[model samples]
Target: MKSLTSLQHLSDQAILSILEQADGTEFPDFANRMAANVFLEPSTRTRCSFEMAEMNLGMRSLSIDEAGSSLQKGETLYDTVKTLEAIGVSAVIIRSKEKAFYNELQDVHIPIINAGDGSGDHPTQSLLDLLTIKQEFGSFRSLQIVISGDIRHSRIASANASVLKRLGAEVWFSGPQEWMPDGITPISADEGCRQADVWMSLRTQLERHDAMEPVFPNYLEQFGLTPERAERFKPHTILMHPGPVNRGVELHTSLVEAPFSRIFKQMANGVKVRQAVLAEVLKTKEEKRYEKAV
Candidate 1:
């Protein structure tokens, strides 16, 4: 069975195929199939999007969280997933605090969709982001995209940057100096806002930090998409944020629903992207099963 643990596992053709599938009106039926969402970490967007995708495809969804799962009783992630697989769940979508948590589940046969793994990679999020960008720009080549915010703690930053760059987009990182990673063109937030085709903001990720300072006092003025900074943006520049947005922090409250913002559009596209992913992955499993039966 195929699993989508990273974007590295997906070819350009495969990526385009999924996006194409998402835009189609008809979908395959998996009425009797079951999918499980096993989120060890807190989430709203990814989890809910997957659940909605599952329902849209006529699949039953089983939700498992830290509080309600065997994980609370010292069960390992592998054991928990194996249990679901043993029970014949069609696929398992997981979000974990541990980076590359899927490494531990290599032996499990079901299709594993990495919802988010610590700050490592979030393939599905990257796909939805691509869908959002593609819907707006209709292409990725030579597009100036600036990913600005808490880069160190952002899976969205890490996931999208590499893929965007490989797809021929000129990608840059702009945020707090402390959060900036090496090996990318780091620009000032002002420069990004002024020139970017897509200005994508990341959340502060306070829960991942050691300190409880939820909002840095000068984050908005310095690195965030404030109304004043946004005014400097090109007329065609589109704003993006991987939600749950911290109003007045990574983005000012006024810009959340501004004419140029694609924050909600990203969330809306997420369901279709995930629906494409689930359908494609599970279709392979069904094909193999048919082959074996024949």
Candidate 2:
């Protein structure tokens, strides 16, 4: 309850409760308390969604500038978190390139939400994805979701795989062999498209790789959700991406606007998912305070 670094920290009941709350119109008050968003990495969706979530939940938000803050002057993350605590924030949502970047802040009492950490996880994104899938299929049990494209360095793949499996979804991977991770089934993009109930594509993480030339010059033909491969999908098969989509690289540009594509819906649901998360964590903090008072 104090921190949300992984989905494993939550039970099925807990996850369901949050999702239900996300669907409601009622907003919880946090008196005048605030939350800090400290993003050391570039973000658009995650950052904006969380800020909107804060606004909808009746909580003020503080945006930390890593450049302007003492981090540029070599301040440790622990000290920065402690400073936010000193400023009386109720929670801290952080995104950094270092995996488990907040692990060292054992003494910091505020709730810490991990926005993302290297190729580690994007739990909130996965939760919204679950919400989107649940809306479409009613449940995750026995559903087939084929995730295609860059699997080796995608945090979305790592986060979604664990949660989807926990909810009884069969996850398959389709991409170049070099992009395949250990234990993932190496299905071809076309075959995966034909068999999937959902087709999720990923952006190539060029930033994560060291100096290298393009391994596959024709990535669209080799691994992308090209129009031909997309045509092979069943009528009910949905398309999804945790985007900043490389239009033709991961999926065809036209497919992004396809009727089955839930990419924009995913962005919309992100605010609700984050609102529920912030409310739940802040509510726990409130209860703890009341308990000590009694």
Candidate 3:
């Protein structure tokens, strides 16, 4: 078993195992968690998911914000991390716009759970995505998922690509050249959708500041998944998004509330997935101690 430096820490078999273990516990006693919340970027879903996961595990937590920390006094990120670790932090659930923080963090004794990092990878999103897929399709094999919009700046897309591919599924990239990843394909947007077993639409994150002239007008005309296309793949496909959704932009508002949509359920899985991750980490730590005693 590998330590969870990234989402790839848990294999497909491990992921299912963790989920199974989590199922044996009730909602409020999922994994017996206790940790420090260290968020650099603002988040609602990641924050609440992690907190709820901790609560479900019957653990206490501390939430740190820039305004209350010496980080505002110009403390280096390394210093901040060291301070958190020194205070006996069991783990740090971090959200940063810089990837360097995540890379440097992998060497630490304390576990680091990335909420989001420099638009690179969001593993938890990948986990919930898998949970959603399993819940709806009842399996992961041979699923054709279309990833549309902001591919160049979408960490969720990258994580999804890796996790889905590892689980024996196909993924297509769709978006304009400016917003899309360079030299990668399923290049055509319309075609990607037409053949998709599932369509996952993403918001164009202007915060990445990766693209210019942010024109998002008439989004439904080109990028948004509509009622018509929904019916086209209705027999075989599903739609998913990670949002603060742009109502008429990347997806129709109605689709967000549709029976097939896993938006809310995904958020709920955030807690369970995280709870399972913490449990696994704790179990590993305990076994090491037992080995030393024996």
Candidate 4:
């Protein structure tokens, strides 16, 4: 309770505890009582991940969107954050299109779990991803993870790369010149996959709307991931995506469902990582409560 901040130095044991919780096996409280967001950005995997996190831990869940909740009246982001905190949201899981979504939170001090902040960072996403990585290799060192495609517009690439690098993997990237992350090695698509222990395909987000470039398909043919391309990698290399994949665009759908795919496992780990985050935040609050009374 003396601390109110989330730490990047989260312990391995604590991380393990959450993973265990996700099994719905046995835990002290299930404290199963938490509040979080849904459908703000038309999500499937993230939306469900937070919801399942709540159910598995014993938290009643709620959904919010333009049509779902009343924020349609030009309410600002800070107001939204403050209101949620005021109503005792112990932890918040957000997914916003704006890259700086949590930047101007005029002191809305709840534990802001970044489900995503556009192409900026998705901290929880990073956590689950690393969890998946750890689950696959039983450790973080020396795993060659390739993050491919949509470099500029995909949060997963940045988050996954950050986490992978943090945990000691040699992470490489491959995508269009425009989408690449700054200050990282960019390998040719084939070479990247060839050397990787995990291949993560990020969806090309351009064609979602009507106004887009004509060179998209050409780009896909060159950069998109396919089974043949994926086969160039180590046979045990895992495949991943943050979903809403473009079938045959950034990646070939069949390859994504290949035997080595860990996309579903990564998605499933989101619930566990969130439960861990929520547990730490709420436990901090409870500790503070007792300290204040004393």
RMSD of each: 1.7, 1.3, 2.5, 3.4
Pairs clashing in candidate 4? 1-287, 1-288, 32-57, 32-58, 32-59, 33-58, 151-179, 152-179
Q: Quote model 3's TM-score.
A: 0.90
Model 4 has an lDDT value of 0.69
Mind giving the per-residue lDDT tens digits that candidate 1 earns over 50-120?
A: 99999999999999999998788999999999999999999999999999999999899889999999989
Judged by lDDT, which candidate is best? 1
lDDT tens per residue, model 4, 103-219: 676386666666766666776677777777777777878888888887766777766666567657887789766566466556788888778888888877663323553346576
Q: Is candidate 1 or candidate 2 better by lDDT?
A: 1
Off by over 4 Å in 2: 212-214
Against the true structure, candidate 1 reaches a TM-score of: 0.96
lDDT accuracy of residue 53 in candidate 3: 80
What is the C-alpha lDDT profile of model 3 across 76-102, one tens digit per residue? Answer: 767787888787666777888887466
List per-prediction Cα lDDT, in the order shown: 0.89, 0.88, 0.75, 0.69
> Candidate 1: lDDT over CA atoms?
0.89
Whole-model alpha-carbon lDDT for candidate 3 = 0.75
- lDDT by residue (tens digit), candidate 2, 1-294: 767888878998877777778877587676587999999999999999999989877789899868878999999999999999998999999999988786788899889999999998888998899999988988899999998877888899878988899889999998887777876667988789989999999999888866762477799888889888889989999999998988878888999989989999999999999988898788888889899899
Against the true structure, candidate 2 reaches a TM-score of 0.97
Look at candidate 1 and tell me the lDDT of residue 106: 87
